[model samples]
Target chain A: MAALRQFLTLNAQILYWTFVAPFAGKPTVRIDAIFQQMVRIGVQAVPMAALTSLSIGLTLAMQGSHELARMGATSYVPDLLSITLLRELAPLLTGVVVIGRSGSAITAELGTMKVSEEIEALEVMSINPIRFLVAPRVIAMIIMLPCLVVFSNYIGFVGGWIICNFALDINTTKYIMRLIESADMMDLISGMTKSFVFGWLISVISCQSGLAVTGGAEGVGRSTTKSVVLCILVMLVVNAILTGMFFIIEGPKG
Target chain B: MSETKRETVIEVRDLVRKFGSRTVLNGISFTVEKGDTMIIMGGSGCGKSTLLRHIIGSLRPTSGSIKIFGEETTTMSPQQMEKLRLRFGMNFQFGALLQSLTVGENVALPLIENSKVDPAIVDLVVKMKLELVGLTGFENLKPAEISGGMRKRVGLARAVALDPELLFSDEPTSGLDPIMTAVIDQLTMDLTQKLHMTAVVVTHDMASAFRIGTKMIVLGAGKRAGMIIAHGTPDDIRNSPDPEVQQFIRGEPDGPVPLKLAPEDYIDRLLGHDRDKGLSY
Candidate 1:
């Protein structure tokens, strides 16, 4: 019963501070801090994200083009790559990369700080830890992850194009032009929207799991694991929701 | 020591903190007076740090009150607690220095974070605190760059940055080498006395506790402690015949005060039938 009460209270506290208050109060988060944390969480996350996206684009295009040739529909292959990469693949891939690179690292760093009493030290020093640490991370992700997603979409499409056009002897201009025509404003918007939701997913889940850490080194590790798993799951869920909204009924008109 | 006399600075009453099904601190009570350094000593997991957290209003009690300088801190609002905490400072075991900042910046944090103090004044205060702990010119160094002893000192500097009336330290020398431990102990004593600040330290360090404690509270076993146990000067605690005090002070292997384990477990361990004994080596 006591354990239940503690769990409820801790949960309530996290919800209140993390979600409820920020929305309710119209809190003015510092712009400079947001930019600074973006450099830390998002900018620092680039290398890993780029690697994952490149590999995903290469592998998927190579296999996808093989199936296209077997169907005697090699020319239409750009459409498949276009819709798949933009509407599903690029955003999902980038989301996973960010979860591993930014999400886990943030959780571990903050968790260690919590265990070491650095958070308490901030409290005693009249500094709000959430404002100084959490707010910036959230703001940075919201601002930068979409831009990163846009970049990932570009690179991944190019990755597929390079494989399809050069490696598979497809007409280069025809493929690019076909992709540009088939890929409407909605596909790009949906892709960008996925990035936005993913950014929120990564930040909120990671910060929560990190702050949940208590005790020592083991606790920090546990928090980091939970953060990555939860962020990825949430990102995938949001991805599914966005894909259904943009692609299922609207088709080419969207 | 300069006509050593101090007044009651901290008054704790019926302070309680519970973790899950077990109540760690059950109606614990104590007082720390000004110019007096009180040590809260206990066996590991004896709720000493819990009690310290309660005093600072960091951990709210299940039920009870803490009056620091006669203000009822237990019921204070978050803002009120922040205001009240300005009167207090803490040094935690891990030093708690902001890793993003240098040692100078870490010390300057209290001033910068709390108030729009003049940059020049903040610098000087940071220097004064650093100098007090014999840290001198190591300001630009980050916590990652410093030794453990130096990190603890940087934490101490940050703690006293605000010049708090009541200073609390949690296991100030838990990880340092012996020489460093002694240096920290002497610093706590000299600084506490020199500054005329009231201090409450939660520690398991017998020698340091004996050396620096003007008043001491020994926490013993219970899901909630049965009592705060012995209370008085360091000599008073050393001479105490209470089984808990004797066992803790002497670092004895066994006693009437049940080690934080169940009766069957204790007996099995005592008879050497158990394969694993965590606290008992």
Candidate 2:
């Protein structure tokens, strides 16, 4: 409960700094800082994200074709793969990958800064540590996570294609057409929305844990671990809630 | 000097800070005047740093009032505090330079962020500040690459980048050798004289404190924790009548400040029966 409150408070502060402060003539974070965070949190995580998505896609295609082929319904493999990847797997897997990669790194970096008094130094310099340090990272994560999900979505389709073309011997044109027809605007929107929320959660939780660190080196390590664990746990729970909501609204996708 | 005409820069009165049930600062009061270098000294955990934090508006007092530049600071909002902080500078115990940024970038941070100065001028000021700290060409180096003493000097350069009217330093000479300590002290003195900057320093180094402090206060520890035991000039502190003040100034281990743990805990810990005991001190 206290963690939830901390999350909300940090998020509110981030919103104020990111969107409202510039209008109020207060110091907002620099664009360069946001760009730098984009490179660190988003750009650097590409390979790991790509690998995770491709592996998931390949496994799903192989498994789906094998299972459906037993019923002589192997043609349904692209439909299954597309809907599963677009509506569920892509965002969820990408979120988990980012949580491990960028999320833990953010927590460790901020935790080290907190213990070493760098945050306090900024505070004493009349610089709001939240505005200067956190807002840019949060904004970058928000922007980057969706981009990653889109990229992962495409890469996941490619993985499915590789299996369909070489191993399954399915017609490439039919497979592509069926996959495209299986997913719609709503599927992409739902996945993008989930990725957005996941990005916010991962960044906020990571920053909160980092800023609240108390001890020295041991404290930073502890908080980094805690942040990652908490991020994964919370993301899973929230993912369920979001999926349920979407399921009810979309009402059992055909 | 007319008392009323002299400007009071920082006025902390009846300030008390308690963490949980343990009181850290008790009814502490002090005033800093313009161009005055005030040194706050005490044993470790005696609330000297806590008092400094309160004065700098980082920590709030449990009770009492703190006024900075005649404005009540304890009640000021974060925005108000930010505005007030622009007028003062604080050098932390560690250099506290952003590890992500280079030393030059660290020094230029305040200048670039707070003002609309040209990038060329910001670089010039950074160079000048670095030169002031005798780190002229070390600007491009990452903070991690610098020595501890060099980092402290860089911290000083960054702290004074804006040429603030007031400066606060926490243990500026703690870990450095004697020569480096003297060098840091000299730089501080130079800034104070050249900029006419009012200064408040928290340190236990009697030599450094006496070298630059125009006024001094020593906080007590143990039974007398959080209370000021001595307040005066260097000569006055040297001639202080209180045994606690004398003991602290003369660096005597056996005095009013107890060096050992309480008798029972000491015996228990020595006997290895304190394994389950959390920190009681």
- lDDT for each residue of candidate 2 in A121-203, tens digit (9 for 90 to 100): 99989889899989988999999999999999988988998899888868789889988888789888889999999999999
lDDT of 1 by residue, B118-189 (tens): 999999999999997779999998899989878987888888898888888988888778887888888788
Report the C-alpha displacement of residue B271, candidate 2, in angstroms. Answer: 5.0
> Which residue pairs collide, candidate 1?
B9-B33
CAPRI-style quality class for the chain A–B interface of candidate 1: acceptable
Model 2: how far residue A227 lies from native, Å: 1.6
Q: Residue B65 of model 2: what lDDT?
A: 100
